[model samples]
Target: MKTINRFFVVLAIALLLSNTSTIAQEQTRPEFVTITTMHWNMDNKDFKMEDWKAVEKEFLDKITMKNEYIAASSFYLHRMTPDNTEVVYVQSYPSWEAIGEAAKRNAELAKTAWPDENARKAFFKKRDAYYSPMHSDEIYATMPNAKTMTAKPTKDMICYVRKGHFAYGEGADEEFDATSKEYFDNVTNKNEFVKAYYPMAHAWGSDRTEFLEAFFFDSMADLESMFDRDTELFEAHWKDEASRKSMGEKGAKYFDNRHGDYIYTYVAGLAK
Candidate 1:
């Protein structure tokens, strides 16, 4: 009788642990985002800017609004970058499964927009002429600690993206995070020029360990002001040159020496 009682107690404890593990997994699922960057086919002399704008309006006015799976969509133009003709399209999703659903819905919407097959072909051909065949796609998992000055902007805002490649060890993750948290609290959070900031990790792409940060501003001029303010804030927070240099050295260890930076103008009217 004593042995049977001990066995039942062990079974109950095991069931409780299993349930706890499942709950943790459900809570920690990350939010997914997809970004596609493309450039205009300038060589296509037949391309008409107004016609291409109409195509984009179709997606913004009808497709995105009608799709339940697409949480948000936004458009951006390259500013202060080598790729002057580049355009970026970003869409946010609740889960990876939502991406597939959104694509299916977009196709359905396209057909509805142009019922005749011939008309559909002509419309898409004209739209395709505006964009180059070559483009890049990236997927990222957004972090939960993102800071936004407002819920969502009522007007267009400038987006500045800085991407870095991660090069640290498993045990160093905690230390790196602690150091970054200090910078964010003292510098980034206190900067008034920046409208919002979002930090994300590369979930699926060529650079698996990439860290991407997006900074938002109210205007092009605000972008320069944000950087100037950051310099002042860094000096105030770190207190001295030596402390700032030490902080930079410590942060560099977690990322590669090379980084990619791009500026974009967020179109509020184009977003869902």
Candidate 2:
């Protein structure tokens, strides 16, 4: 009887230990913050196309090489039509706070690396010539319960770009809250393809009254299929075509331009 009781006690303790270990593993899993910089190509007349490579190389060799804040980084040149854009700089951070700290650290490093104020100014002036005249950024917080795709992204890992337009003269804060809740409580919960979704706003730069919703997937093929599924879901939820069209029209009035998109892959060690 004594041996039997001892066996049961040991079993209970082992089970408790297993459960505790599982919880700790979940808590320690790394989270990532994606920072995307959108920029335009310098006019062909003013800046030679070949110069892009030099600018990119300098950034990788000079800026990123010395920066410790960046976990991983990737640069992309857009391949899509008329948008003949130049570059997309994607960097990952371990947490949101790290994002701010990383920027500060980079600035400090830049100053140290270029002690001459005039030389530093010239460096940025020359560096700025690679892309479009204007640019914007969208910051995303990763989700915990989404499915990541298996196929490698030709550019960045599979990412879903959710573009939103705000009515002219309207503040995005309220609309963002409503739409974000709709996406999380309604869309993502109902759709299994949604591995994770992140919401970002135009904090600085860019003229569009836009918000970006980023979704991650395992592969490009999976990303294509998700749209078909999303279309079906949209039809089912918003059954009236007229109503849907009217809502789209309303969203259109807020923007002078269409939202932009790029599908890029994560650069390992660049993502936190």
Candidate 3:
């Protein structure tokens, strides 16, 4: 996104102070994740969903799956309430060095997969034809409170992403971490409709105040139910109206009113 509005989303990240904390953090997430927002070539009449999947899967099976530096990668197709032409591809790395290492390793893997000079060029040309030349990338630092997927998704899953910005910094990092963790444990963890969740903060991006969160669901029906489930969970956890109101007031201090909601289809075959 050239404009700041066309940017990336949610979470309180924990900055580790010691090796012990770093070990525990790795169990939940990688040190960094890069989300690339790219557009589909609308004028490409020859494009087919099946063909695109086949091409991406070939790259996944040949390079990404075999790449040790990359922890995970996936693609999300736009579903609603945003530019329909957009497709987001995200890749996570264990460390900052791994990000550069993955690129070097991928190059090596590509050469091995297509050794012939002409064949290599031909393969990439076909792959590159699927997307427009313009694209944008943002790198995020993963936070502590994440709901991990138990298993790989077997089909296209409904995914919702929310991006918001931190409006204030009056509270200490400890306070934000405690408050966010409490809510994540109570409401987010108990919400059955939320199949998976990943919360992150802006790392190397245009806007430093940006926060991003990704939620996964089995279907659109389940996605609809997530909000209702969250309300039920929240009420049950808070119990009294006073406590619920206090919780809201606490969170509202850090977040601005502005936010963007995006729905997408999480493609399964192309995941790595």
Candidate 4:
């Protein structure tokens, strides 16, 4: 009886230690989700860029800074000439489950900041008009094998946007998907600097578009390197200049116009 009691006590201690270690490991694992909001530029005739900037500087900045769940945030302006539409903002959260909780906390904070319910609603209403009617988000597991760029001392992270327009015709969607697969297999698979890529669609507000691809990077210098790297990959895979140009032309014909790119610095509070 005495021997059995000692053995049971030792087993209990071992089990307790094992459980504690597992919990610690789970807590330390770095997992994050990105919540992206898309909106169209305010269509109001009285819309002023200065006023928008002020709101960003005052309310938006303050709220984001105070939010604990936000890992990073960024606001981007479209650089393309013809597509002057503003990209608005993208924010990151520590986890997908935290998204709803974060929003609830943010609302509570806003109420405390602005006691008047009408005033709070008005502020958000104005803010919401800056983005497209439809925005969707997806969660991606960061590739463990990929190299991660160190965050800059200034807390600025560069994002490189690469938009792909789907081809036109009865089988345009099929062709676009096939091209994407080829691009990923022949091009992106070999590129080391491609940090992250997301595919999007024009659901509402904007005209119907087959696809949009957003690529992320740490710096503009990396963007310059991609051009040289991508060209080499293209030549190697296509074998001839004519074949390469044909593929490019076919891809371009799918869109009403050329695809767009925009660069923005990730906000400190929002970036992971």
Candidate 5:
């Protein structure tokens, strides 16, 4: 957890050395993101999805929603993974220092939310029962040029994730950054089918090669439409075949020729 939190500090220093100008231009995006992979306790025969959601909502309202240091918090349930028991919790911070500050804030809020000691204990016990002990965590650094949402969603959305591996021998940092920002501005942001998109690279995880792109859609139909719309946007944005090929080849140089696709349902009520 400490290593994961420290990623933003390391990321900030690297970015400053390579591209300090960007930091001054865009300060709204999350600096760091922590992803926790956990499993539902299948052994508990009394489990109900609503009950779990309710418990989580209680905690979110009490702690996460009130935390000044936590920029954003969300929960994602496995939709198309190999296993059904997986649940993911994602939290983003404004700065690396905010990670430690948020923990301290949560403790203070928890006490205020449940003033009675016994009630606090009972609430936590109930919450803990819903999840298994086994869990893993990874931290990622948000890349430039994301397709941000125009408004907050009121319902659960389907999230399609494309995970790629970085090749690391790409040319100058300026070339990759310029190309990525240009592609996102011209093509990605124009896709009507895609509600929101986030591109992240590994920061403090086991696999440094990891690069994950999450695209959100209103439904399964919209997700399929996004692919068709992607081709249309790409062609329309880059008319000539040579221009398209050049853009593709330049982007391809940054990543290995391998990626994995995963799907999840983003719970609106559990979001902060």
Candidate 6:
């Protein structure tokens, strides 16, 4: 009886240790994203696209390439938006603290790139002339389930983003995540149209309740096909009309009606 008791105690300790290790791994998951949206100062008489592109290229080649903390970067031009001049810049960091480290390193690299103080000022001035003062920034924790379905291409890709806010309730987050993961695994992962998909949630941002999902496509035509495929997948998953309506209602309750959709053309050269 004493030997049996000792075996049970050993098993309990092993389980506890395993659980602790899992928690630590979860806490240290290495992925964070920063997104910023800005509008171009199109009315500026001296703002020239050719000149601005040169400055941008210098920034990317000199600054972004040397920044050790920046795992990847991408620039996107908004398509079919109310503001035709808007641009979105996204950077991924291995950890949350890496974001701040990248900014410091980028500043140092800029100085090295333009060693002359006057030249640096002129370069930055030209860069500043391209963008308006107004901008919004958001930070998100990249979820573990994100998948890259294709090789990274050296050309443009279409990005579709859906942003939504959640309504907090007891156990609501767990319920929503379980259902959402099921949808991603059973439907989205099965869909061949989207080249890549990433899901993220507010980490350190203005809106604490926000959630974002982004889908990538090789071209606009592929994006159109993805939409049609989505409807078919939904019907296949939730066969009956009543069952579809029920699941939709359940999902709807988890989120606020406020959401935004954005389409962008990802620039190849601007990405790291």
Question: How would you order the candidates by lDDT, starting with the best?
Answer: 3, 5, 6, 1, 4, 2
lDDT of 2 by residue, 106-220 (tens): 7887888788999999888887755556775655433332333343344445554545443355434344334333433444445556555544444344533555555676667
How do the residues 134-235 of candidate 5 rate in per-residue lDDT, one tens digit apiece? 999999887666778788889999998777676677567777666666556666678788898887777798998787778899999998876666667666
Residue-level lDDT for 39 in candidate 1: 93
Q: Estimate the TM-score of every prediction.
A: 0.78, 0.47, 0.90, 0.50, 0.90, 0.81
Q: Clashing residue pairs, candidate 1? A: none
Clashing pairs in 6: none
Per-residue lDDT of 164 in model 1? 61
Off by over 4 Å in 3: 1-28
Model 5 lDDT-worst window of ten: 4-13
lDDT of 1 by residue, 1-272 (tens): 22221111111111111133432454433367899999999898877756766788776776788887887788888777878989899888878898999899988987897889999888778778888999999998766435664666778789998776665533254455566666677667777887887767777888875767788988878877766676666667778767766665555555445567888888766777
RMSD of each: 12.9, 15.3, 5.0, 17.1, 6.6, 11.2
- Return the clash pairs for model 5, or none: none
**lDDT-best of 1 and 3:** 3
User: Between 2 and 6, whose TM-score is larger?
Assistant: 6
lDDT tens digits, residue span 152-258, model 3: 98888998988877776555556566766677787777878888988777889899878778889999999877776766666677788787666655565676667
CA lDDT, candidate 1, residue 96? 84
What lDDT, from 0 to 1, does candidate 4 have?
A: 0.51
- Comparison by TM-score, 1 against 4, better one: 1
Off by over 4 Å in 4: 1-30, 35-37, 80-88, 145-158, 162-222, 229-272
Report the Cα lDDT for residue 22, model 3: 45
